[model samples]
Target: MNKPLLLQAQRPFTAFAVRATPLATLCLVALLAGGCASPSYTITPEMQARAASENPAPPKDDDFPAPGSAKWQQGAFPSLEALRAMRTGMGKDQVRGLLGFPHFSEGLAGVREWNYIFHFRTGAGPDYITCQYMVRFNADVLTHGMYWKGAGCADLLKPPPAAMQPVATVRPTVVAPAKTTLGADGLFRFDGRSLDDLLPEGRRKLDALARDIRSDSGSAGAIRVTGHTDRLGSKPYNQALSLARANTVRDYLVQAGVPAQRMQVQGRGESEPKVHCAQARRAELIDCLAPNRRVDIEVLSGQ
Candidate 1:
C-alpha cells in the first residue's frame, strides 16, 4: 500500500518535469533571437537637423558607442589633404578609402551615419586638436553630408593662406661685373687694328666670352666696346686706329653669336693711361704702356 502511494507521487513529479521542459526551451529561443538582432541605424529628423547646423553641439552618449565597446574603433590620424578630398555623393567605400574605418559602433552596411574622433595638427608643430567628425549617408549608403563638433574645425579642410603657407627660400642672383678689360696685345698682332689682325689666342678668348654672354643672355643688357691706344702716335692717328680696333672687336663678337644691336663702339686714344713710364728705352716704354692699350667691354644688367 505504501509503494503504491509513492508511485502516485512520482507520476505527478514526472508530469511537472515534462511541462517545464517546453517552457524552458521557448524562453531560451526568445533570448537568443533578442541577442542576435541588429541595432537600428535609422537617421532621425533630429539627427538631420544637427547635421545641418553650422555650429552643432558636441555629441552625447547616444551619438556614439561607449569606449572599449565591441563596435568602438580607435580613430585615425588622417591627412589634411585626404579630409579635404571628402565630397558629397561619395560611396561608402570611397569615403572609407580616404578616412579609414569610422571610430564608432555604426556598422558598415545598412548604416546611415558614421562618427570619428580625428586629431589634426594646429601647425607644423606637434600640437594637435582633437575633434569629433560625423559623416551622414543617404538611404543609398552614399555620403551626403559632414559635420564637425568644434568651432573652426571645418576651416582645417581649406588650404592655408598664402602668407601662412611655407615660404620657399629664394637665393639672390649674383651680378657679374659691369666692366671687363682685355689686353690689346693679347687680342691682335702688333699695330694691328682689323679683324684679320686677330691672333688664334684672341679668337679663342672671344669665343669663351661669347659663351659667357650667351649663358647670361637673360640678364645681359647693353654691351659697350671701347678701344684704347698707347701715346706713341699722333692724337688724330691714334684715335682713328683705336676706333678701327673697337669696330673690329665688335664685329668679331657679333659673328661669335653676340647681338650686334646691343654693342656700341668707342675710341679713347692716348688717354686714360694706366702707367706713366720714365723708361728711356723704346722697348721698356712699350712694355710699360701695354696696360693702357686694350679693349674694354661693359655689360649693363637688365635688372
Candidate 2:
C-alpha cells in the first residue's frame, strides 16, 4: 500500500479497537451489578422468640343503641315502610306499635340492640324487597342506631369499592342491588304537586351531599338520583326525567373529581308504587305512587 492509504487504514483500525475495549468493559460492569447480593443478618434465640409472639387486639367500644334501650320489630307484613321512616333515636314503644312483636334482641355493655329484617313481595311491578334496622338503647329508650338493606350491615363500618358506582338504569331488568337502607322511607303523598317538581330544598340537600362527597376525597361511590312521575305520565317521560335527575347529581360529583365510573342511576317510572293505596294513589298522604319518585346513594371500595 502507498503511504497515505496505509496511514488511513491504520487510523481507522486504531479507533475501532479503542472503542471496542471500553464497550466490553461497560457490559461486564452492568452484568455484575444486575446480580443479587445479600446483606448479613443475625437473630438470637431471645430475638426469635420475641418476633414469633403475637398479641390480639381488644374489641373497641361500640357507641350505638344506649344502655337498657334495645327494642326490636318483628313478624310478617308489619309495615316496614313505617319503621324505616322512624327516627334513629325513636322510642322503643313507638317502633313496636309500628312494626309489631319483637323478633330477636341482644344486650351489650350497658346497652341493648334491636334488629329487624323485613321482606316483601312485588305486585304489578318491581320484584322482591328487603329491609333491616339496627337500633341501640339507653335507660330503656332509643339512643343510637342505623339501617341497612339486604346484607348492608358491614357497610355501616366499611365502605364499598370506589369504581363500583350507581348509574341510570339501562332497562327494567338492570336494577342495581341495595347498598344501604333509606332513613325515612314512607308517608309519601308528596303533598306538593307537579310530577316533575324538584323540591326547593332538594338543591340544598344535593349541595350538602356533593360537599360530603368531595370533602371525603371522592370517597362517595355513586350518586343515585331517580326521578319519577304519578301514574298520569307516560313511561318514557318518567324514565327520561328520572335519568336526568340522576345525571344532574352524578355530573356534580364528577366535576368535584369523582370518577365517572363510580356512579349509577335508575328510573322505575310508575313501577314501584307505594302499596298503601294500591287501588287508588291520589287521596292518601305520601300516596301509593311514592316509590316511583325516589333516588338512592351508595358507596363501595375498589380493587
Candidate 3:
C-alpha cells in the first residue's frame, strides 16, 4: 500500500547505526587491551599457610629480662640441685655440661677454680646482690665446692621487709685539699719555666697531679702554688725565677680545668729549705742542697 514511504523511513535508521559503530569498536578495543595488560591475583592454600606460619626472629639480649632480675637468674644460673650433685670426682667437662659456662674462671693455667655468679633481688628496686659459687678442681676434676653469699644473699631465706631493711646510707665523700710538695728538679730543665723546658718525668708527674686536682675540683677551693729556688742564685734572680715557675704551674693548672681565679701564685725563693746543707762547693754538696729547690702545692678549702 505504501512501499516507497516505508523504504524512506528505514534509510534514517540505517544511517544512525552506521555512525555509532566506530565509537562502540573503540570502547571494545580499550577494554580488551586493559584486560590483557593487567595481572590477575589469587591466594592459593599453600600461600595462605606460609603466611600464617611465618614468624619474626626471636628477641635478642636487649629484649630479654634486665640483668639482676628473677627472670635473669632463672635464665642464667643453675639450680641448687645441680650444685649439690657435683661430686669430688666429676671431671671439668662433666661439671661444665651440668652447669653450663662459668661466670668467671680464675687460675685456669695454674689453678683450677671456676666461679659462677648469681644475682638476687631483695626489694622492688632493680638493685641486686651477687652470689658466687666457687668450685675448686684438681687437674680438672672437681675437688670441693662452696657457696659464697654476698652482702644481702645471707638473708635469702627471709628477706627483710622493706620497712625492716637496713637502709644503706651513702656518705658524701669529703675531699680535702692535699698539700703536695714537688721537687723543682723534677719539673723544669735546671731553672726553666716553659713546658718545653720540663723533663718528661716531670711532665708526667705534673699532668697526673693536675688530673687529680681537676677531678676533685668540684670540692676544691683556692690552689696555692709556691715556688722555691736553691741558695745558689742571687736573691733578685731567684725570686724572679721562682715567680716565673709558679706562674707556669698556675697556667698548666688552668689548662687542666682548674679555674684561673682559684689559683694563687707566690715566689718564696730560698725562704723554705727542706734540707739544711753546710757550706760546701762539691757536686755532692750541690745534690745535698737539692731539697731546697722545690714547689709546694696547697689545696685549700672548697668554695
- Per-model TM values vs. the true structure: 0.42, 0.31, 0.41
Comparison by TM-score, 1 against 3, better one:
1
User: What's the count of clashing pairs in each model shown?
Assistant: 0, 28, 0
What do the candidate models score in CA lDDT, each in turn? 0.70, 0.45, 0.60
lDDT digits (tens) for residues 56-138 of candidate 3: 34333243223353312433535544554454434555666677655532322344555566665547988766565555554
| lDDT score for candidate 2 against the true structure | 0.45
The candidate maximizing TM-score is 1
Candidate 3 lands at a TM-score of 0.41
Q: Taking the tens digit of each residue's C-alpha lDDT, what string does model 1 give over 41-95?
A: 4543333322222232445546654445524344567888678667544565677
lDDT for 3 (candidate 2): 95
**Candidate 2 runs further than 4 Å off:** 1-198, 217-230, 255-261, 274-276, 279-281, 285-288
RMSD in Å for model 2: 28.8
| lDDT at residue 100 of model 2 (Cα atoms) | 50
lDDT of 2 by residue, 139-251 (tens): 43442344443444333222223444465566233223334322112212242212224354554454555545544542434545453445545555454444444454454
> Ranking by lDDT, best first?
1, 3, 2
Query: Candidate 3's error at 33, in angstroms?
Result: 93
